[model samples]
Target: MSLGAFFLICAMPLLSGCAGFGGNEAPPPRPIVTAPPIAVQPPPAAQQPTGVARDPSKFFTPAQMAGRPLIRVAILLPFNSPRADIRSLSNALYNAAQLALFEFNNPDILLMPKATGSAMLAQKAAQDAIREGADLILGPLFAEEVGAIAPIAHASNVPVVAFSSDTKVAGNGVYLLSFPPDEDVNRIVDFAVLRSMTKFAALYPQDDYGNRVRASFEKAVADHGSQIVTSASYPPNTEGMNLPVQRVASYGGRHGALLAKRSELKKAGDAAGLKAIENSDTLGDLGYQAIFVPEGGTRLRALAPLLPYYDVDPRKVKFLGTGLWDDPSLAREPALEGGWFPAPPPEAHAQFVERYRRVYGAEPPRIASLAYDGVSLAVALSAHAEGERFTTEALTHPDGFAGVDGIFRFLPDGRTERGLAVLEMHPTGAIVIDPAPVSFGVPPAL
Candidate 1:
């Protein structure tokens, strides 16, 4: 089948009336239909069958299953987490998964929600799901919880599409569906290199996320035959950012050069040179064409202005970032006005957000798409013959699967590679400078 046809087939079952398929021609407009919200309720206690095993059928009514062959998909989340924020996120994820289930209209698939408020609980939940004959498993949002369930899922040969971004717990039957930092780094660096940016610098936080982005950034620059002129890491706080930003900006060296230039101009008694140096605090370029600021939110706002303050002119030096810069508020930061970042194509995500709002009456968190895609993928794959469905070969298909986030495929190592677009920050909004590729191996139009 053609890529477009394959995507239309896989995506039609999940999307509302095939709304967001990729092609040159726009899909015809359809009447807006508000789907009934899936109820968010506590799962009833599981009833054990005649022997030691638990009956997964007990989790659903006969009418919902409708006498079809069962495909139990266990979704483990921290529904009872001590933290309110975690609880809310868990609920949202579950709701998204439920939305996918209804939209796909798959009667054979039974979604099982299990609480994983702690690592111990997560392990037990995995045990229960396996014992209950879960054909596939979906979540357990944190890395620690994923670790707790990986061995159990591997032992049972049950494939898990998890939501955690940590690659440490991914592999051997556990695949992460969440966005990885490497994707953002690779996409942005590839676009920057294509745009003739060779010399690079970075200012990243001195934490796990920073370390991951730094490693990816270095590898990407080297892979593209570019060089890192300078980089610095600092604590992710307002107070700890100044020194690192200044260091990356090369303030001391440039300031010393400015002083030397002023002295030379005075000795020569050149009025034009003196006047040119008068308003500038630093002299000479930072020797980098682009600088990576892989930060977001308050930290980004705090860290951005420091570059211009230390004479790293944004006009001359392009500011690059990861997906963290997807925030619209970042447009207000003059330092990021011309910055470039990689993110999922916004048009599809915007449509998804609108549908989610219409159904659930609130804005879904950005990561909520992970759950929707995971369930949609499962439903799409379930159409395969019994033995072939949910296997490594089927799940790792090179063509990948179309998702709300974009086209993504599972790597053998259990990491997901997604098609991302290069977006430029503008005062009005972020605009796509380069579109995301619709299929693997085909490059996006520049």
Candidate 2:
């Protein structure tokens, strides 16, 4: 079997271009009915991509087609890597994309799969796809790999739909389909701003991921006309969490005030009044009304109990978070209960999980759905203008595309904004405080 330089290539070549694609057709009037905001149920398995080879009249209308090329797609992934550890992840992603294309089952579209093991190898594979005349490309999972192949794809005027979660490597003809931390931070913090939270503080870990979350938190807070009053970072561990937690809670001032007030009452010899307040921790209010803890999983559990011990009570200071707080395990910690954050609607993903488990015979990672959504979106776009499907104009559709993680769209700048719901932590799990909207036609009311 001939590989498309990247993957198994079809012997057939398409003759369609995006030029005559409905150019002369009149634009339809704006629809009175809106598309569903988010699709919880996956698209039916029998669905097909649009523009399956007909009499060429569909895209060209007989007059325009004259002779154009059909759309060709190249899928790039680290299928054979030196690192054996990530083989499962890469295969899962590849399988998801394959599923999307399989479900599409469009005869008009031509596909190529490119496998790369390193940055240099990815560049070689990408060049092969371009040589094969691929109109669109999908994936190269890591940031460095995306960085390596993006220029090659761009040189060929082909847009890449990459699955890298890192947003820094995005843009210039590459679209990252992975969930970036900015989306989670922006959604949750905006919800906080909507709820009238003014002052924010953070107890973040001293690491790259923590820094990214903190940066996103800061930007979100500033954009909302709020401010971060304090931020403290600690090395990852239970060993040194006390210092950072104390600094974030402002233990010195709070405890100092308590001691001073207690001294004042003692000097006056009002033993009864002193007794009434001696057992209390609060003597002065914390500067921030909300504290954003971006920690997740076991690390979050370690940090949570430290807050109340430092005289910082969640009862007073609202606990805020990103998707990191979505873990059901966090609910076991009483301090995390009632904490608020943003995440995709769970019901939609629940359906996907069941479906995927049935097919794969194992539970797929959450990110596997991202791969499916990316390929599925490409199929949807191919219906309109196959060759020009990856245009900036087409990709940044304001209404966005509904995927396994609800609805998301690419911004003109290439940042992805997802329609997310605010969830509150309960002993049972993270429950939706506000349901995600059906469409982002209107921004959520502040």
User: Which candidate comes out best when scored by TM-score?
Assistant: 1
True-structure lDDT of candidate 1: 0.82
lDDT (C-alpha, whole model) for all candidates: 0.82, 0.72
lDDT of 2 by residue, 145-229 (tens): 8888887777667888888878888888888887788888888888888888999999888988898998889888999889999
Q: TM-score each candidate.
A: 0.87, 0.77
Report residue 203 deviation for candidate 1 (angstroms): 1.1
Residue 45 miss distance in model 1 (angstroms) = 20
Q: What is the C-alpha local distance difference test score of candidate 2?
A: 0.72
State residue 266's C-alpha deviation in candidate 2, in Å.
4.6
lDDT of 1 by residue, 261-339 (tens): 9999999999999998799999887789999999998889999999999998889999999888988888889988889
Per-residue error (Å), model 2, residue 269:
4.7
Query: Number of the top candidate by lDDT?
Result: 1
User: lDDT (0-100) at residue 142 of candidate 1?
Assistant: 95
